[model samples]
Target: MSLRVEGLCVARGEAVVVRGVSFSVPLGEVTVLLGPNGAGKTSLLEALSGILPIQAGRLELCGREMSRASRVVRARAGLSHVQQGRVVFPTLSVEENLRVGARDGLEEAFRLFPELEKRRHTPAGQLSGGEQQMVVLARAILSRPQVLLVDEMSLGLAPLVVKRLLPVLKGLAEGGVGVLLVEQFARLALSLGHQALVMNQGRLVYSGPASALLRQPELLQWAYLGRSA
Candidate 1:
């Protein structure tokens, strides 16, 4: 496994947003995290990436314990998080944004996102939503992380645009990176995932093969309602 979590818990101020979550993101696979709104999906990703402090439980990256590690430490230890919003330096060019992650990875980033190469000199703010997302993803990829945590990469984008991006994530998994994806489009995400996990109200209600969940809609519905099938 590239990333492992055991009984992980996280609190937002006084309220606990994530409760006793445990899972493993194996290398060379995409693990889709599905849940309803306010189900703590984003919180779990934040905790895993060190954006939020882990109140309890263990976090291991490539077999190294890092529960108490800072965000910088986690990033350096081969973890990269492409957050919900397409965060990029508005005035910076696509090539410049990628270089911020790793100067040597510019060509590799351009190769993965040829569209970005065409606009290499264009400022990020001028790109469309889909293009901006590509820049964010490319920046994360430039880091060459062992585990990638992405939250809502499809937010506010057209379905066709989302479809185009999904394959890239799968390709990353095929190339030995463990991808933990938190997405609202359950069906779309499951179609590309090797494993599926369903969360409800800060707790995991389902964990199994992605194909299994895809085949059984009732099971997924039950999980969304915080009940066992």
Candidate 2:
């Protein structure tokens, strides 16, 4: 499934949030959205997921246009999003939450993150932050989406936990799913993604091979290491 965003623009009321953002996530690989806070990364993800309206431009899933698709239409078309904040049903059991990811159950995500299996009966709110986030992702994966838009998977988690998550994401890309990961840490995004796009004030500033960004110390400094933008 090829996911294409051509001149995609999103707005909040009359104020534009994501302006003319164009990029393509070819099937079977990971593409990272690198940006600072308030860069419209989450808004773009919302647009792609059909949760927010697009003020202008287009989104294509496979060959179909999605700029005006309903939320259910988007979900059934194989687009899944794990938004920031890991909003799970606090009262729901872990297994119940996993069930929300897919009807067939938690086997696949449990296979990917075995830790979930052991605590399947616990309440979602009882799990640690990383565990809860994994449960959220597990549910999204169960939807069997071809395109996955993940926002801040590393937010407020230990580096080691994030380190573990990236490999599972890699396996997803290797298996022919398109991943659009919105990341706070450009270093991690560049290291994990096949390609990277930098977003600032809702516009894409730079885009190219992850390795290319990785090689330029000055660019990394501007992005994650924190010198200039």
Local distance difference test values of all predictions, in order? 0.93, 0.85
In candidate 1, what are the lDDT values of residues 98-159, reduced to their tens digit? 88888797888788889999999999999999999999999999899999999999999999
- Highest TM-score scorer: 1
User: What are the per-model C-alpha RMSD values against the true structure?
Assistant: 0.8, 2.2
Worst 10 residues of 2 by lDDT: 220-229
Q: Which ten residues in a row have the lowest lDDT in candidate 1?
A: 103-112
On residues 1-229, what C-alpha lDDT tens digit does candidate 2 reach at each position? 6899989899888789998989999889899888777888899999999888988898999999888999899989999989889899989998998787677856777898799899988999999999998898888888898999999998999988898888888888898899999876667777878988888788887778888888885775565432334
Model 1: residues >4 Å from true position, as ranges?
none
- Give the true-structure RMSD of model 2: 2.2
